[model samples]
Target: MKVNYDAQNDVLKISLSSTPVRNCDFDKPGVVLGYGSDGSLVDLEIREASRKIDNPRSVDLAMNGRSVHGVRLL
Candidate 1:
């Protein structure tokens, strides 16, 4: 999985190579979006990220519909 953001286009893209993506759909007026392959979400994206999400934790919270504080890498 890889994530990229294009500030010029105001587009945030999340892609899953192993899972594959057949289409992209906006979940809530472009703020949150779903990346689907065969009707299952392979990835997710957050648009206008700077406005809605203060940090990475907010992103997880929004996507999962919960209050996920953070992600740890080791």
Candidate 2:
């Protein structure tokens, strides 16, 4: 998995897999979803990320009630 923010483009991209994307869906405003040929999600992109998100450059991962990782400074 990968999360990236492009300041110049104001885009936040979260890539879940390296599999090739077969199609894309823009079902919501400022959002784009990528799906693989087998209908599995591959990636997601959020446009105008800075305006919509509080912080577009950092990530903190948690699972169940525990923190898997600390705040990651990207």
Q: List model 1 lDDT by residue over 47-67, tens digit each.
A: 675565554322343355666
Please report, in order, the local distance difference test score of every candidate based on alpha carbons. Answer: 0.57, 0.89
Summarize candidate 2's per-residue lDDT along 1-74 as a digit string, tens digits. 98888988999999999999999999899999999999999999999999998888777787788775546545
Best by lDDT: 2
Segments of candidate 1 deviating more than 4 angstroms: 18-20, 32-37, 55-74
Off by over 4 Å in 2: 63-65, 68-73
Note the residue pairs that clash in candidate 1.
Answer: none
How far residue 20's Cα lies from its native spot in candidate 1, in Å, is 4.9
